[model samples]
Target: MIFYIAKRLGTGIVLALLVTLITFLLLASSFEDVARTILGPSATPETVTGIMQAKGWDRPVLVQYFDWLVHLLQGDLGVSVYTSLPVADSVVQRLGVTLSIIVPALILTAVIATALGVWAASRGGVADRIAQGVSLVGYLVPGLLLAIGLVVICAVQLKWLPATGFTPFSEDPAAWVRSITIPVIVLMIGGIANMAAQVRGRMIDELRRDYVRTLRTRGIPPRQIVLQHALRNAASPALTVMSLEFIQMFGAALIIENVFALPGYGSFAFNASLQGDIPVILGIAAFGVLLVVVVNLLTDLANGWLNPKARVR
Candidate 1:
């Protein structure tokens, strides 16, 4: 198991490095001056050249990439051109906002989706049909549209929750929760559908296994057999889907963050792109690639843990 995990970690590191290098190359090849982005076309050539020199954009691409890579290794992720804030600090400050909503939203999604999946898999008739219908509704609803609808219904029309923006937990915990509650709900629209599909597919497949029949023949309670035996055995596949869903949600969070005006890494990335802030854009891209790699690594580790056969193979 340890060897398997080590191998996965090694592969994940190599893949992440490759991603970072490719992103660097793509941005470097653009050859646009950062000063033009910041100062407009009226800016003098000397001013543009000076800004590029200050940014070390005149250096060899490979040298610049190596310098950036070294800084990343040393925990200095560059500075934001627009904000003048260290990229690492910027990422840290906003991480809590995303995590607060994502963590609870993940739990909510898992519980609700799992319940629906288990109920549908066990009932296998009208109940299953109803569950499928609900899942379809969730799947069809685009996250941004759902967020907009919620903003109007809860914040504008009913005057219950705040439509957008966030409050720091340190300032007012209640307000913090209140602000993110709807945004999290919006995030769960696609999450619930994806998780339900995973759970139902895995559970239904597990039910047909020989051990499931044996457990029933031995007079085991139906609920116990389904929940304890079948669910546990089916967990690997469900987890696989859950991991993919998490990656999808993270990517979607960019749009959802902008809609809700939340100060998260996703929102930061979106704003940076609009401003054509190369350093910030690259930093955001690197962070995103890192996040996905970590998630994938964790998923690989979990797979090994859940199914020992995977470790040996």
Candidate 2:
């Protein structure tokens, strides 16, 4: 198990490095374009040259990359070219806001999806068919459209929640919930659909296994057999889907944040890209890759715990 964990950690580190290096190279290749955006098209060649030289853009690409990497390792993500703020600080602030929404949404998604999946799998009647239909629709609908529709119905017409904007939880918890409700619901729909499908399928498979029949023949209670035996065996796949769902939701938050006008990492990265804020862009990209690696690693460990066969190697 330890060896497996170490191997996964090593691989994750390498992948993170490669992602950051590729992002840096791609951004560096567009240095001139970035400079033009920063300096304005009306600026003369001398002005561009002066600005580039001041920013050390004249350095060799390898040297620049090494410097950036070293600084990043030391927790310096550089200053945003557009915002004139430390990239790390800006990203951390925005990420905090995003996490506030993501954490609650994730918890809700996991509990509700898992419950619905187990229920549908156990019943396997009209409820199962209905769940499948809902899951298909939820998964097929585009996130942006879903978010907008929810806003129109729940926020605009019904007037139950705020339509746009974010309020920090510190100032007013109720207002924060009201503001983030739509975005969280939007995130939950897709996550629940994906996770529930995986869970339901796994649960059904577990229920059909020989051990489940043996338990039933031994006069074990149906609920105990399903909950204690089937659910435990089914957990590995469900966990895998949940972990992947987390990554998906992280990516989706980028678009959802924009739709709801939340000042999160998604909006920060989006605006930074449009404005050619290289430092901020790189910071967000690096953070995202690291987050994926960490989540995957954690998921692998959990899977190994749930199913010891995975750790045998």
Candidate 3:
């Protein structure tokens, strides 16, 4: 198990490096333009040149990447051109806000989606139809439209939650929960829609396997066979789907954050992208890459745990 985990970790590290390299190369192609954008139209050509040289943007792309990588390793994400704040510090603050929504939503999504999928597959009648119907509705409804509808009904009409703004959990846990509730539910709807379908399909396939038939012949209880055996095997693929959902949720959260008026990583990244803030954009890219690598690593580990045979592979 330790060796397997180490292997997965090593792979994650390599994946992170490769992704960052590719991202850096793409951004570097127009590296010189960043100085002018930051300085604005009124800035003289000499001033732009000076700024570029000082920031090492004039260096060879490989040299710049290595320098940036070194700084990244040292936990220096550079200062934001607009705010002059350290990117890491800014990201950390906003990341907390985003995680406040994502973590709970993802946890609930995994549990609820798995249960719904398992139940639907095991019941194999009206329950299955109901689950399918729910998935279809979730897929058909645009997330932005869904978020707006929720804001209208829940926040505007019913007055059940705040319409916009956020509270830090450190200051007021209850208020934080209330603030994040609607956005979290919006995120969950998409996650559950995607993951539940995957789980249901995998569970159905597992239940139809010969091992399931043998278990039935051995007089294993239906619930035990389905939940303990088939569900465990089925969960490997669901875990993969769940990991992918984290990235999708991250993208979707950008739109949701705007609708909900939440100050979060997504909002920050969106603004940074618009302004062509290279330092902030690169920092965000690296951070996002790290997150994806970590999630994929955890998914691989979970798959190994669920199926010991995977450890050998």
Candidate 4:
């Protein structure tokens, strides 16, 4: 198990490096005109050249990347050109806000998906068909549209929740929940659909296995066999889907944040990219890639724990 974990961590590190390197190269290339954006249209040629040279933008792409990489290793993500704040600090603040919404939504999604999936798998009648239809619709709907619709119905018309804006959890816990509720629901809808579908399919397959039949023939109760035996074997695939869906939820947060006017990593990245704020943009990109890698690693570990056979590989 230790060896497997080490291997997964090593692979995750390599993938993170490659992602950062590729992102750096792409951003660097597109940033050739970045000095103009920073200095404005009225700035003269010599002014732009001087500013670029002073900021090390005139250096070779590889040289700039190495310099940034060195700073990154030392725990410095560089200073944001727009805000003049350390990129790491800015990202950390936004990340915390984003996670406040994501974590709870994830927990809710898991509980709801698992229960509905297991029940549907066991019942396999009208409930199963209904679950399948809902999952299909949920998976197909765009998150931005869902968020907007919810805001209109719940916030605008019904006046039950705030239409836009965020309140920090520290400021007021109740306001924080009310602020994030719509967005969380938007994220949960798709995640629950995807995870539940995967869990349902896997549970069905596990139920049809020979061991399940043997357990039943041995006088084991259906509920016990399904919950204890079948569910365990089915968990690996459901976990895999959940991990992938979590990443997707993060991506969806980009649009959702804009729709709801939340200050989060997604909004930070979006504004940074538009302004050609390379440092913050690169920082956010690297942070996002690292998160995905970490999630994948954790998922692998969880899979191994649930199914010991996986640790052998």
RMSD of each: 1.6, 1.4, 1.5, 1.3
lDDT of 3 by residue, 5-37 (tens): 999889888988888888889988766677888
TM-score of each: 0.94, 0.96, 0.95, 0.96
Q: Give the higher-lDDT candidate: 1 or 2.
A: 2
Candidate 1 residue lDDT tens string, 31-116: 45556877686888888888888888889988998999898889888888888889887877776677778877877888899998
Tens-digit lDDT string for candidate 2 (1-313)? 8899999899999999899888988888777778888888688888888888988888898899889899999999999897688889888999999988888888899898898899899999998997798799888998889888999999889999988899999999999989989888889999899888988999999999999999999999999998998999999988888888888888888899888889998998889888878888899998999889999999899999989998865
Error of 4 at 192 (Å): 1.5
TM-score top scorer: 4
Model 2's TM-score against the true structure: 0.96
CA-lDDT, candidates in order? 0.82, 0.89, 0.89, 0.89
Tens-digit per-residue lDDT, 1-313, candidate 4: 8799999999999998888899988887766588887888788899888988888988999999989989988989999887899999999999987888888888899989998899889999998998898899987998878887998899999999999999997899999999999989999999989888988999999999999999999999999999999999999988888888888888878888888999997898889888899999889978898899989999999999999999887
- Candidates ranked by TM-score, best first? 4, 2, 3, 1
lDDT of 1: 0.82
> Once model 2 is optimally superposed onto the true structure by TM-score, how far is the C-alpha of residue 165 displaced, in angstroms?
0.7
Model 2 misplacement above 4 A: none
Is 1 or 3 the stronger prediction by TM-score? 3
Q: For model 2, what is the error of residue 256's alpha carbon versus the real structure, in angstroms, after optimal superposition?
A: 1.0
Model 1 Cα shift for residue 226 (angstroms): 1.3
